[model samples]
Target chain A: MNVIEARHLWKEYGDNVVLENVSLAVKAGEFITVVGTSGCGKTTFLKLLLGVETATRGDLLLDGKPLPDEPNADRGIVFQRYSVFPHLNVLENVMLGAELAASPFWGRTFGKRRRAIREQAVAMLESVGLGTALLKYPSELSGGMQQRLALAQALIKKPRILLLDEPFGALDPGIRADMHQLILSIWRQTGLTIFMITHDLKEGFYLGTRLWVFDKRRHDPQAPNRFGATITYDIPLGHTDRTTLHTIQQSLGANHD
Target chain B: MKRLINQRPSRAAQVLLGILPFALLLLAYLWASELRLAANPNDKLLPAFSSIGEAIWSMAFEADKRSGNYLLWVDTLASLQRLGLGVLLSALMGLVIGVANGAVPLFRAGLSPLVMALSLIPPMAILPVLFIVFGLGEVSKVALITIGIAPFLIRDMQQRVLELPEEQLIKAQTLGASSWQLILRVILPQVLPRLLDAVRLSLGSAWLFLIAAEAIAATEGLGYRIFLVRRYLSMDVILPYVLWITLLAFLTDYLLRVLTRRSFPWYYNGGKP
Candidate 1:
């Protein structure tokens, strides 16, 4: 069975249809990267997968079962900003997931359980190159470091699906390069099904095993919101050529214009 | 060569500038009092600085012959206790209701408008009602203070919680946080420092309500003493009591500021976390 399967998914906010007829089957361990124009509903699709937004109409199945209406431990998401808890330190941020799971009411664990959570959080942070910065708050870290902390915080829960909403779009190029390498290594080791949305086409191409382009196949100039966006391209990576990339880029630019 | 907007005084200059107005006011008062005294040795309107000094010394240090209690200390303790209890209760209610109304949609829809309406109602207008309901005692006084400022604190805390990024809540939910857990781990921690801020802002009004309540009904509070001496035209006692109240309010605000900075450093430092 596929890890995720969406059949004719449609999301509309009142009359404004955001996503329409988005159908796809994602196998486990597939790193799917989504790219689109600013209002092309890529983020909406990601929200649906994370279960933050429900589909207006369609069948979204997880492991051959209906997707949960709300977010849960099965899915983990890291947004571009405000992803990490501002009040928690680095280690505490990572430990929060386990703590909430263990002591649902108090959101904390004491004694041996807490020590175990600390060790696990430390190891997760160490994997993300934040071992030395465990005591630092998210505000004290640089943008790159904060995103690293966010990633560690998300991954600490051991979710089956990892979702990234333009996680590196705000970082400097040099730092983004390092983040790319780190994320790739983590993905390879975990074999987690990852869905990442990126504005940077090159970054998307570099990190994804599969690439999806969200664009409206039908446009109505008289009624702009008449048609919603759909997956116009679902290209399997590893065989992507320069001409195809240039063609897609030109089309996207034309759509923007 | 810097423009006025760009110019900033040095630390010592800043201190001097801050004290300049108070110094000028004191000098003017002293000169006026001296002139009034030269004209009439028994002038009661503007008491001489020495008389005010003596009043402070006597009230604060010397035990009263009738009660054997230092009037200043007794009044200070009574006022502080009422203000402390009222503000503590207000903070607790504000945090719980604010978090509930801000975070939970059902609670927000049901209670936000009610809280909004309550905040709009003048807390002073209901002072008489409170007196009738709770009797003319410490309960009425403390209840007045709590009712006066709690609505504002609740509104402030709710606004702060609402202003928090939606992504944080979503991220917390994805991390397996239940509704209660989300409030405990995510919303409560973030709102606590902000709650301190709201309480600090509301302290001025809290003091106002406390004084008003005490002036009307209490027998031993600072406000009661001030109003009591007004009949005798005791400007000396009134002035010192007013100054002491101002000092206490300033110290409370300063201590709350320091506590917020020390306890939640991230709250003041850009709030990026």
Candidate 2:
């Protein structure tokens, strides 16, 4: 069964339409990569799926049920900047999910439950290779470590659908490659449906089982606001290799990076 | 000694540099006082330092003949009480209004402009209104300070909360946090440091309002004592009171800085994780 189903989704802010007629079905365990130019509504689409934003038209269904109005534990997102709470340490950050679930307010879990939650958080931090930095604050970590902390924070909640908005966009190429490998392995082990948006076509093609390209195809320069970005290309990358995608990119002859 | 521009000096040198201006000011004041006192042994505008010292000893240590109260201590306690109450109430109001302004669009739209407009009004100008409404009591003075400083504090807190990245809020919500949970866990903790910062900044104005309120109508306060002594030109007593108030203000600021630093080390670390 498809974990996510968006049927002709439309998003508009006042008269300016940001996204129009974006429809896609995302099955469980599929790594979906969305690649488009800046201002092509990729992030907006992710926001829509995460329920940070509402569609102006059409429906989005999760497991054949209507998506919730607000964000929930079932869907998690990691931004490029890594949205780890600055006030929390590595352990507290990873434990935040269970803490929030156990006690929504004050973030205080006490007694045996607290001990259990701490153990879970500690295990999660260990899994992310942040065991030594357990007491360290986010500012004490490097960019790659911070992103790992962010991933641990999201994954600790055991989300069914994980969304990444260029989570590796800020890392060095080598670190980004390492993160790509880690994320792919995690995806394999967890079998969570992942939707990622990126500007780097190579990175997108390298990781995704399915690729989506967003663009405003019917753009009139005089009144460009009239047209909204739509998913122009949907390519299933399960069989097609990177070389084939690169050739297709050359044929397009545009800045697909 | 060679002085390097922009380079930090040694600890002793830094202390010397900090005290240099104060030393010069004191030297100038003493020189003028000596000249005046030499000419006329009873100049009251700037009394000799010895007389001022004597006044401090007596006012701070000894009880008043008529009222049987150590005037300086009494005044300090009264003024500190008023200032503390005012600031505490202002902080509470600012946190609530500011968070509401940041989190709720309806609340922000309705009240933000009103707060901005209220903040623009000279707080001193409405002193009479507060006195009339609250009466010439501690409530009036405390209320005056609260009204004077709370709006600016609220605005500052609102801006800080608003500037928080949208992703943090969304991420918290996705982690199964409700609106209340998001605020209590996410927004409150982050904005708290900024609130402390804003409070420290607003304290200067709070002191201004407090002194103004007390000076205009009070039987016993630092401001009242200062103004009361001004009539007799008792610079000896007045000068010490002014210094004490300044010392108190400085101590409050320093304590708040230390508290924020100790309580939220992550806040001071620029929120890296």
Candidate 3:
């Protein structure tokens, strides 16, 4: 079954056009990267599929089911910034989704349900090499460690797919590369489908099983007072998908190192 | 010199160093004040430290003679009761209103300005109005403090909740969290640190307002007791109460900071404050 299928999706703000007709099908366990220039609707498309924002006009389905309007425990997302909850240790944050999933009511009353969730979170944190950091706060750790904590948290839920929106975008180049390797290794072991949105071509080429290009657009899709921008492109990866990204100086386009 | 500078003091030593100035000032000020107050016994406005000490001693003596000094504890408890109820009510109400304003588009647009305006008004200005509305009852004092502080807490919380990342909230929703669950889990946890600060700030402010509330409206509270002693020109009684309030505020703030540190050990604070 297709893990994700988005059809003729369009999202816009008052004067910004994020995506015109973004439609793609992600297969199970496939590592797909949506790449574009900065301000390209790559993030928006990811949001649409992840159900962060409503598509102005489109149908988004996951596992042959209707997409949800709000967040669920079924999809795990990691952000560019370490979006770890500052009030929780690495373990609690990782355990959050699983706890929610295991119980209809995620609270102190459901203490027994929490044990299973805790065990799962510990296992996922260990998988991401963060077993020692479980007791550590996100602040006490290095950037790489924080990112790993976030990954542990995301995977702890055991979501069907991982949605990453430039998860390493904010890190320094060296750290970013290290995180990419760590994430790739974790992804291999877990075999969870990954759909990451990035403007970085090199990372995209290195990581993606398949790639889609969202055309650049000068539109603000979330403008509340007014209808936003119009949609633009979905250029396929073509040979870039088959070859090492180093060979595609052309598709790298204006996107820099 | 560089090596000496590089050597950092231990935590205990650092705390000792921090208190050094206060200790020195306490000694120096004691001498200075004694000399000043000795020459000015007739000055009734700012009662002398010695007289206040005497007065506080006498009041304690009287409470012991009359009510076995359980009343002293009771009055202090009474004042704390008002503060506890006032601050808790304000914090919860403020957080609810502030979070509502932040999350809802129309409320965010409409209520933010009104809340800000209310926050800017001197809390004392509303004291008279509170008396008219709530009467000179315990409820009046508690209500006054709540009204005075809730707006600020609400405003701060609103701003914090508003700034919560769209990515994370939406990510959770996409994961299938209901709207209510999103709030209980994602939204609450994200804004908790700031909310804690808000609660602490309100608690301190509530006490500050409590003095005004207690003094004007009622009898049988710490503030009223302080006022009663002031009438007899007893500064010592007032000072201890003041000291007690200060101690409470300090302890509460310290406890909150510790709690924040304990909970969010990974909390890498980027805020300038």
TM-scores of the first chain across all predictions? Answer: 0.98, 0.93, 0.81
lDDT string for model 1 (A1-257, tens) is 79999999999999888899989999999999999988999999888888878999999999999989889989999889999988989999999999999996799999999999999999999999999999988999999999999899899889989999999999999999999999899999999999999999888876789999999988888877888999988999987788878888988988768
- Compute each candidate's TM-score over C-alphas: 0.98, 0.94, 0.77
Find the number of clashing residue pairs for candidate 2: 3
Residue-level lDDT of model 2, residues B1-273, one tens digit each, is 446675787899999999999999999999999999999998898898889999999998998999999999899999999999999999998999999899878899999999999999998999999889989999999999999999998998899889888888888887888878888888889889889999999999999999999889999999999999899999999998999999999999999999999999998777545
User: Arrange candidates by TM-score, highest first: which order?
Assistant: 1, 2, 3
* lDDT of model 2 at position B138: 96
Interface RMSD of 1: 0.9
TM-score of chain B of each: 0.97, 0.96, 0.81
lDDT of each: 0.92, 0.88, 0.72
For the predicted complex of model 3, DockQ is 0.32
Each prediction's fraction of true contacts recovered: 0.86, 0.82, 0.33
Q: How big is the positional error of residue B93 in model 2, measured in Å on the Cα after superposition?
A: 1.0
lDDT of 3 by residue, A22-41 (tens): 66777888888777666656
At residue B154, give the lDDT of candidate 3: 92
Report the number of the highest-lDDT candidate: 1
Q: Can you tell me the DockQ of model 2?
A: 0.71
Per-prediction CA RMSD (Å) = 1.2, 2.3, 5.5
lDDT winner between candidates 1 and 2 = 1
